[model samples]
Target: MQTITVEPLAQEHIQILRLTSTPHLSGGLDTIAPYSVWITYRLNTGANQHTWTAAVSGYRVLRNGVTDMDAASIVLTNLADQDTTPDWLTDLIAKYTPSW
Candidate 1:
């Protein structure tokens, strides 16, 4: 099994943010996690808003919200394609990161 994280953005955070799945999978430079999961979407934005915004739009959106991993995947997938990656989101990621 794998571990995932879901974080809700608060006052300064904005909205709920999730960051899950590791970039380093069995293969090097794969299409990323959700790609295999089979969820595709699109979004366009300014350079500054690219990362996080993408995350919000195409976000995987897991079926359940009880677990952290579920929420993280949805948020990360969306962030991967977005133009806005906020600090609160990053904070969540850090909390769940292996190093953290």
Candidate 2:
């Protein structure tokens, strides 16, 4: 299990969790495209929140860190239709909302 340091619970103004799946591309050459996943996360603002979903490749994520889930190659780059909640994430949530 990997870990990422995010904004402390008290300092955090927003947070989001997203699930994504990469589609299998079948083709010879020109038609082939790098595998990518469509992910969505919940953005919790101090006053409001929303969800943001996008189709992105693992390379992009590694190249550009995506919040606390950054550099999660094995976790984010794999092909699967499921949800993964890291322990750190759970802890973070609990820290913010003790009752949850």
Candidate 3:
């Protein structure tokens, strides 16, 4: 079983967790004409949180997992600034698997 943990930098803000729910195209004419991936944003606004029950398609998915972090970062260029990398992400991982 694989998973990820996250936290917000500030107290007033919210933290969220989201993962791909489906497989989609890499790059093809049909894929270019209309994006083929599906993303579900689960928002956690402090005391409130919700999951996307119905897939809201159109974004691309990085299937290579961690090795494709760079590519995944590109897919979410708009939100890349919010990524918890190197330090923060490391802390999150440690909390989950301290022995590792």
Candidate 4:
């Protein structure tokens, strides 16, 4: 079973400052243990075709007491400036790559 929960750490009008993810639990990616799960959502509202601004957005690998996979401090850039990925996020992606 896999689950992802989002909690607003800080909000400002239509722009959220610090959005965080709850403890994500999964059986592992394709039978692997201790894997990272990262999820992304669209910020565009389809009603009138408008997009909201988010100052921060990312996933944190929840563990018992390990900061090695924790991404709570990572802040994502805007969509246009997202060409370069953050080192921390990249690390988690590599660590959790499905081996199956």
Candidate 5:
């Protein structure tokens, strides 16, 4: 799980509802591949209750028999600045990478 900080939204409140991952299955039954990981997060905001889902994908590297995933490669959807990656999101992705 990721620790998300509620940043000041200028009269708006954003709440992260859920975070889930859909892993790519390998050839064997119930086997998961670490190459591709898809992470999805649902969020609700403000009084009107606007909700949205963001999906991010990244590949994990297997080096020295250890699995490693880079958060910098994970791209988040619906961000104001696509070139700039948020710290919180990077932390979240790093925290969840081990589980995948």
Candidate 6:
């Protein structure tokens, strides 16, 4: 007879672990465009952690490279759709900004 062992399922926690953005330059110039934001967030789940990226210009969001509309709506609502930029994103941009 063979013995088998099984591990318990990991707890699920859907939270944003990290957020990053890449600003696109306008026509290869130094100017950044509002619509050229590409936001990527790490969705942390104990055993199913993954990253999602969204294009603010096209309103397209993807999870692990596949289209996820529900996440898209959530990302847009909390990030781009707001009247003002989210503080977290603003801070991230600031961190990357060079002070001269």
The lDDT for every candidate, in the order shown, is 0.31, 0.33, 0.29, 0.33, 0.37, 0.37
- Residues 27-99 of candidate 2 have per-residue lDDT tens digits of 2221212243333344443525433332323322322333233222322211242244334333334444312
What TM-score does candidate 4 get on C-alpha atoms?
Answer: 0.22
lDDT of 4 by residue, 1-100 (tens): 9898976443222322222343332222211122233223333333332222222322343455333433333333335434444454444434433322
Looking at model 4, report the run of 10 residues with the lowest lDDT sum. 25-34
Candidate 6, which ten residues in sequence have the lowest lDDT sum?
24-33
Which candidate leads in TM-score?
Answer: 6
List the candidates ranked by TM-score, beginning with the highest.
6, 4, 5, 1, 2, 3
lDDT (10s digit) by residue, model 1, range 1-100: 9998965432112233333553312111222233222222222332222222223322233334222223222334444423343454444433433210
Q: Candidate 2 has which clashing residue pairs, if any?
A: none
Per-model C-alpha RMSD = 17.5, 15.2, 16.2, 16.2, 14.0, 14.3
Number of backbone collisions per candidate, in order?
24, 0, 0, 0, 0, 0
> Between 3 and 6, whose TM-score is larger?
6
Q: Judge candidate 2 at residue 94 and give its lDDT.
A: 43
Q: Which model is ahead, 1 or 4, in terms of lDDT?
A: 4
Q: Alpha-carbon error at 67 in model 1, in Å?
A: 22
Q: Cα miss at 62, model 2 (Å)?
A: 4.0
As for TM-score, the candidate ahead, 2 or 5, is 5
